[model samples]
Target: MAGSLVKRQGFGTAPVFLTSICTILGAILFLRFGFAVGNLGLWQTFMIILLGHLVTIPTALAVAEIATNQKVQGGGVYFIISRSFGITIGGAIGIGLYLSQAVSTAFYIIAFAESFSPIFNYLLASDFNILVYNYRVISIPATIVLILLAIYKGADLGIKTLYLVAFVLFFSLLFFFLGTTEYAQNMESIPWDAKILNGKSFFYFFAVCFPAFTGMAAGAGLSGDLKNPSKSIPRGTIWATIAGMIIYMVTALKLAISAPPGDLAADQFIMQDIALWGPAIPIGLAAASLSSAIGSILVAPRTLQAIGADKILPNSFVNDWVSQVRLKSNEPVNASIITSVITLIFVIIGDIDIVAQIITMFFMVTYGAICSISFLEHFTADPAYRPIFRSKWYVSLVGALACIFLMFQISVFYSIMALIIMAIIYQTTSYYKEDKEGLANIFQGVIFQLSRRLKVFLQKADPDSKEDHWRPSVVCISSNTFERFSAFNMLRWISHKYGFGNYIHLIEGYLSRETYKEAKECVNRMVKLSDSTKSRVYMDTIVSPSITSAIAQVIQLPGVSGKDNNMIMFEFSKKKPEGLENIVDNFKLVKSTDFDICVLGSSEKNFGFKQNIDIWITSKDYENASLMILMGFIILGHPEWKNARIRLMVLSPEKELEKQRNKIRELIRTGRLPISLNNVELNEHKDNIEAKSIINEKSKDADLVIIGVRTEAIKHDSIGIFNGYEGVGDVLFVNTNKEKEIK
Candidate 1:
């Protein structure tokens, strides 16, 4: 069968509203309404109802907003949650929602048997002990019958039955209201006490009463079945909540005024005693329980089907099995059977109060997650998160907080248990191997917005105020580092000085579509290399036939204005490439763009252990001294070079050498190079040959060499073959473009 044909939609607005009403106005109203009124009195009973709705209203609004934001499918709450929070959290909450619905089916079926057992009490052969034992035994068959009816008839029959049940429920309420009127008139004779009647606190009553309002999710769970879920869900949920609230409040008022406080507190079957016709009470209970069971059974299996269809859970066999549908009915028959089996287990256990508490805890977490998604979407201000059903962020925040607060208020142990189960499920689902493409959950948007703001703030902050504030903002030509990985490694090390690096890959060809694709692929490879090397480098590719023009354009690449790339670097090959001369001629052009330049010459031998760095200084190259010293400090800051020694060597005549050494000392102090004056080496040289010989002899064993490069050296192609440094370690030739002294 086709997938589309297997997922059927038939519900309209009226059926959805009636289904929710029937679900919310379940057996609790018939069996437990007097318990609340008796224990908490008229005022507190109304307060509990109001508090419950306060939490649910935001959750309903959140659901409405999310439903309208996207196309909703079978999962209902699970669908919304998974779409908003991703599969892991969605799967966890999906399981929680499924279990809640399954257990809720049993809860209502047990209520049915509890109410139905009274009819058998009048049988001559049955006694009280038989009533107690047979009530749970009867629930097993009652649960099976409801599940079977749902499976055979499908949701259409369930909706029609809910319509009749809703009618009968209102009819029974009319008689209840009529019977209470006479007793209400004699209000002065009834004792009204608002205290702990049965050793249960206000919050305990609140927990039991809260589930009465949670049936709102029944309409939402029918999202896939609805004719127009986005339109129907908001309308049905809001109307049902309002209707349920009114019914609960009016029932609370009637019960409070009609019965003596002692009878309201002590009698579990107080509604039957107060009914105009005794059978009306059991009839209402039966209708409420059966209707609620039908709604829960309808919703539970669909939730399981959604989880299975999405492949959020680990077991693929279970996922495939539960997601299967009957071709003719287009119903989740397999999923329904699974739900029925789970419900049967709970029905046999038949502990109503404990079941209610557990159900309440699960719903609280589910509702809180919904509200939290809405709150995050609004606060994160993601453009894609525009929801048609607009709501305030603070309101959603309050709703989320209220749901969490009530969870603990109900029972801290159960609340903790719910959270632990969800966390474990989330962790487990996170390991599921699935391609999560085109999925952007709300938390991603939140992190994105925060990162964007932080980036802006960082760009505005001054980076030159202190040594700690200094960070490398570097741009290197890709041609200089391709296959010459030592150059890329140096760039990585320099960029590790706490800032950003960008690599520009300029394709020296006509800018055609194929060239653009090739350049893009090259940039991707470079980015992958950056990842493998654990470096923070961004790669950009440009196709331009003229390498010089590309370099010129790259030097002016726009960025956060003041924090743009402060330096441009290139590699000097031993045998210069074809465009090396032209690139050298454009050095002044690059300087005009306000970026300093550094050309690297990698040794044939690997850069040996990074134990020593040597900086060769000349009288004419004083302008590059501070930058070279800063580079040495930055290199030493890296972990691999942390113990590396830095020595400043001046090969001037002895008379001028002390003055040059003193100047180097002042530069070290001013630039904060973290080196001692004893590391400065001054040697006498009579001519350029002697100076070159002195550098080769003293720095031959060093791991790295730093020297100044002038335009004359580049014009002669002597930049790579620095005098007396042919067999040395890695070399860096610095040319200062800025006039400011290092401070």
Candidate 2:
């Protein structure tokens, strides 16, 4: 359910709307103010921009084509690249894409801050610095705090917040265009001068417009998660593109026509001057800028994840829970926070001008690689892809060419800086690739091959193990405290991480208020434990007698289920062995070797508050295979003590045995527990050996030794569990995976 909920969340209409509007406003305004010495008027704007749009259109088309095949993953461009080429290529693209987005967020934040100062400085007493403007949008501390909260809380909450903010920005942009156009008495003429096209001015104009159009594919990536991706994505992309184009066209026209040439060329973000129309106009643009920045933050991380999955980059960078961390109801909260924090870095930057330079660098360079990939889709007979929405080869060719040409238009120095960073990243990534390949090859050939020659390598965690049919019977013991919290933590300590071992929890019986209070504390302590455990079970306390009486009574009463073969574990904190003697005495006569009891250490609530768990479990042998049983408990402590280990062992009668140990080694790979395993299987069956002799030989220096006991059927026998556990000796005998007797 958590998984399903995590998949559906996407950037809602508000983000899309604002992003589109911002696109229109930003494109138009920037194009007009950039004042590329292009003598071209309105009509020539089309041809100059046509080449730029060519560079951008392929990005969207390729994104859509890739999205169609692998839409649900939401890995974005990285996903497309990884699936077609390979994970190594994907990972590289992923890191590059994500870092690009991170850089892009910072750029937008600076842009938002820069756009606001001229309007704010005029009206407020606060003297905003124009010299070092972009970096100081909101206080950096405030922004960082916001970021931490978003991530600490997770993705669902963060995305919703961003979507709402973006919505407000959409209206702001709409109002900026509507507000400005409402007043302009004369429309600027469409000039068709060939002079503007001849020089570097056209290229520079294309360069400036490049970064503005990159965010539209963000919405298209949602196709996989959408209700109907094939239909919805195509429609959304087309609409979003058209929407972005309109905003760009209108804003540019307004800026060029209305502003005196001197004022138009005064600043890059001259769109902010629309406040001259009315006070409210400034508010809209400010809101729009904020939204644009947020929209970018929301879309970028998934791109990295998708790419990471394909192996083009380091898979380690991919976050498993990102798309799934539902915020309030369920939103992409993790991505939002990460994006926002990065955005804030740029926002508070002092130099507003650097904002444009960084933004230019992100789009110009990243897009070049993307366009190159797109070019491959057309030029080469690569079977890797088939376009869902094929642009004519000429269109694809022009887009790729245009993207390449725009790269040159950007300042050579900055372009060099971007390329150098990319090259270093590429080299570092290539080395890592070689190392990973080496490891894979070693594992495939050398390690296993050499293991046969090394005695030490052949030695298993357990030297002597019985034929494990893997039918280790499961016994689930639960009490009122079992699922309450305390036993939960204890179970966690008992279970191994990455999912290993068989486990059982003593669900103590029910009690009156006073005992309930005591039991809850015990349960809380158990739940708070940091030990590695796989599964936790609850025994019905009220089904029979209370926990204290049930331990005594269950032994005397006929056994119901798994009382014969499996050992039962009981946890209590009596310092002296006297209080537990009665518990042991009751079961002593049931064939002494039939079962065993274990006493656990008492838990201390030192700080009153601890990591997610409330219990602490310590086995004499911290490394135990029995820890695998604590899976549920281990998961319980996942909020904290995520890597808590469960050292465990299962003592058998025989001292030496061998069986399927390889499967056991691979069981707990999720990064929690490192298993330490050992086994002692007695050669002779109990009938042939003296009970004393068996006990001495089986548990010479064992931390815990559990055995099975005979069971009887009683009226309350339906409720089966680890009976006579509370008063056992140092060794603990637990039940099997089943509720049957170990006998």
Candidate 3:
């Protein structure tokens, strides 16, 4: 709910098309085109225009297709990305897109001020510094006026203004074409060589030209306002892209052929001199700049509003303030205010060249991500990803690669900076995105395909030949985990990372619909526990009159094909639980199914924070020794217990204590455990001392204690030996056989 909103539709295809066209035909076309043409010559300038569109068309197609497939709303590009990739990634890119749009608004307004500087010169007749300084003075007021216009009038007025700007832009283009034709007829020779002038590479010109085509997202950012976004987005976006490409190619051809390269390269404002009417150039520049600024101010606030509503931003006060909408127009009033402040700062302090390059990098990454989403959706073939507008997966893949390639070509340092910034945002927002239900995105489909392939590969492999690759596959029985949480936590810690656990809860009633319903509810609770503990647990429930029979049946079944359950575990209380005798009788039944046994005895106090582990060693029961030490390592591997220290303790006669210590040290060294000889302790006492008493005395301070269970102990009461040591801490009584070896 925090990351989503409902939007009202108002725009149609004409407004969307005009908005996209006006944004692409920005002030840069008038101010920066001559620079690009002069540096790269005629054919290469044309290539830059064509290549920019080539990289952008796929992103436009991806946006249109994805917009049609979903119920699109105010977030625009961010909404599509989040819905496709989930909240974490969506939040990251949304912030970046929002900042880019805000900065673009200032960039355009500053460009507008610069275009009118010649008029200021005509009036003031002052030095260049005074005129240039006055540009900032003009830009601050211009930014404020646009922000107020956007907040009060909303996108409707923005679209209407774009309509007027589109007319002016086309009229100016007509005069430019007419004037260039006359100049071409008079000129005897044209410079056609694609040579770089003033030590500029093709990439430098490409960077300046790239922003010309990046405005395709303007229509996409207004997705929430479209009357029929599903139909209008594809039609409007494609037609606008085609129109911009044609205009760019035509303008590049005319600029290269009509003027001398030396003259074109000398003047950045050559458009004004070359136009049929000189004033029309500055007028067109002003119109284009204002229209693009208005477009950005209209769309950027909505993106901010979307992210704020979804609670992705860190500050709650800021989120609540920015997400507020005006009841009259449903305009992002507060978001627009925040965006205006950021734009004003950029206008005051930001350098146009540096800001332009940074803006290009941000947009390149955004476009790449869009194409990547489209490619993944097609490749994974998720049933929910059906779209009205479809394109080939390879096409989307190529588009994504091209966007990334061009980003580095433009500036590797800026590209890396943009990527690092997005990554940090992703990490921060992912920490706060708590709604798991909202995580249904394309990654789920990708993971599903990967898991399916892995299952196939595992099924075909030889089970016996891969014994060395085996890890623990455990089946644990617990009626109510809350009542025995320590036992459950112990099982989770032991099976963390390298093993899988199947937790079964058996209902003590006749097999009826009511009992089955109750069992299912219990299973859900167990699943929640598994998620909270960050453990790999598959929960199952069964309604049976005989608890022991239910457990035995579950143990006999394999969790995955070709991987049988190798260990069965139960919780031990000092006072025997109900069906204790049946459980004891089923131990042999479990062993017949090739499973070892484990029982946990929990202390009354919660487990300590001290990371100390004690294991009691007697004779060389290598199987049990390996299993116990492995469990110790697993416990220490957890982030909370990373500092845990393990010790192998043995009780022996005084004369043989040294021999026992050497033997245990040799075992640990050969076993390659993360323990050392200093950790192996031998306790020598008189013949009157019992092994259990020795353990109780020595391991009282340890957080966890592990002791191997003999066959005789299993045959009698398994919980009796550990009764005196329950107060020490959590304890695991491990029994192992030669049937299965854990890797």
Candidate 4:
């Protein structure tokens, strides 16, 4: 169905230019510019024209840039958007765009009905009792005729009709500019700032005028019928946009000079009185309105057909119906019927004030999305995105921003409603459709570029600014990853906030092709595991020959947070401490880098509910006390530990217990730590008592026990210091390289 338009010889640039220009100078120019000039004055009206072009001009440039970069298929704007941003997000916006285009058919048809007002007034005066009181007499027939033409004759008839209307529109404007009124000849000087009293506000008029510029993309809707969309689209769209802006500026000026502000404000058809041939104004209005309606009728069905072809709708049956095309003529018959139904329903409603605002919001969102794609492509600097016609990044940025700003500026309620509708559509499509290509696929490249730039900036910053406060930049190495999750769990808690963590899975083997492939699988497994837990730790794999060699390689790895690693963590089971010797042997090498160390001794309980944490501090462990407390605080920052509490247990001689208790209290207060005084306990220990027995007896109920590790003990081969902790669920032995202040 989408390729139906490509079967023919295809149109040249003429239809593209005619379709857009006709819509650009349609009902708005004939019906509303006089009102704008009267309310906002000539200078302010000029500003409105410029402001509208601010959005349209950039959008034109963006469309040109994007069309040149890729093959634009049946959907036109929808095709360009879905291909760049992925189908799900693009489908969400495409639905809105299609509805707006469909409803616009009715909007223009109703305006065309307004052109019958002069005849209706004459009928009412002569006592001709027909349906002259109701404008639907004209609207309903006009709508049926147009729908029949679309269903039978298709785009071929629509393009031919556009050419005739475009000619009438141009002649009407010329006659209005040529005529000279008494007000213009008698005026001493032009009133550049003349406006009627109690007129509408600037934004109100802006909302009324902005849609005129939106027709610049009217040509893009014919992309499927173009011989070469990459060349014809840019040329037709840009030329129409500039021509429309210049014509509008001149039209505003002519209206200001020809008519008084009072008459212009009172009569929407004041151009009739100003023109040399008075009847030409109403004739032009009727022609422009019909042309725009025909343009919309031609474009809306193709958009719906393209969407159905992509299978974006939830129901397969509906998709099949909408995507069906006429075999010989290559026309979207079913889609045209749907578009007609939507248009007729809105036509019956007649008063579409609220609906019009919503349509405006939809157009604004589409324009913004196009500009965003162009800007992101520029930012990513992807080789695949090279376009022959390039738009400046700043121009695209301004266009995107203006669309968003003007959305709320036009109507805050409608803007929010439009966004909510798109979100709902996106989620619904995502649930029924399995599309891996999504907004994330595009953002991935954008995030990579951003991360690279930030890393370089941070690396070049002054080092002194970073040393004032300390946060953990931890690196964890493990070979028993599948065997236990304690190491990974710790990494997640630390990396949750205020820190960074990188976990490397150590495979104790030489690097081979098989090993490299296995390492990639291991990384994928780790990623799935991390995603399941919503963990923030970055995962990787290293295939080194020995645990010591892996540890040496892992320690040199930089932190993902763009900081140097300051802490290293290792894990082993308490029941089987086979990996402890290798870790102890590499302590000297880790110490040479001045990195703090944490060795986890896990048990069968697997941290046991994560409720209670016990931190044991001794008089001889002054250097490790601050780090141990900080680690506990950092772990508590994770939501998994939300209900958990920490107990700071201190051991000293009986005489010095009071001194140590006050010192701990002062540190907690100064650091603004969450620990209460009641949770801090002081204990008396004699010289004969061993530290292991005291920990086993006191911390039996603790889910986790944090105990200080001394360099002197490790150097002297005091491996007994880490043994005999069967009572506790898990134990973390913390060693600090230097004293860290609480502040």
TM-score, one value per model: 0.75, 0.48, 0.72, 0.95
The sequence of per-residue lDDT tens digits that candidate 2 reaches over residues 107-203 is 5555555455555566454464434333363535435654564455433444455566556555655555655433245544533342333334555
lDDT of each: 0.79, 0.46, 0.78, 0.89
Top candidate (TM-score): 4
- Angstrom error of the Cα, residue 276, model 2: value is 8.6
**Candidate 1 weakest lDDT stretch, 10 residues:** 433-442
Model 4 TM:
0.95
TM-score of 2: 0.48
Worst 10 residues of 2 by lDDT: 613-622
- Residues 1-743, candidate 4: write the lDDT tens digits: 56444375378888888888888988899899999999989999999999888899999999999999988877788888888888888888899999999999999999999988777766777767554767898899999999999999988888889888988998988888888899999888878999999999999999999988888888888887777988988999999999999999999998999888999998998999999898899899999899989989988998999899999999999999998878666678999999999999999999887898899999999999999999998988887888999999999999999999999999999999999988898899889877757577678889999999998898888755748779999999999888899999989999998789999998878999999999999999999999999999999999999988888888888789887799999998899998888888899999999899999999888778889999999988888988998999899999999899999889888888888988877877886455788999888888798777888899998999999989998888556768878877899999999977666
Model 2, residue 245: what's the lDDT? 67
Across 644-724, the per-residue lDDT of candidate 3 in tens digits comes to 899887766788777877776666667654578788887886678867778878888888888887666768765354466
The candidate scoring highest on lDDT is 4
Order of models, best TM-score first = 4, 1, 3, 2
Residue 546 displacement in candidate 4 (angstroms): 1.2
Task: Compare candidates 1 and 4 on TM-score and give the better one.
Answer: 4
In candidate 4, which residue ranges exceed 4 Å CA deviation?
1-6, 122-131, 188-190, 463-465, 668-674
Q: What is the C-alpha RMSD of each candidate to the true structure, in Å?
A: 6.0, 21.6, 6.8, 2.4
Tens digit of lDDT per residue, candidate 1, span 600-628? 76766556899999998788777787788
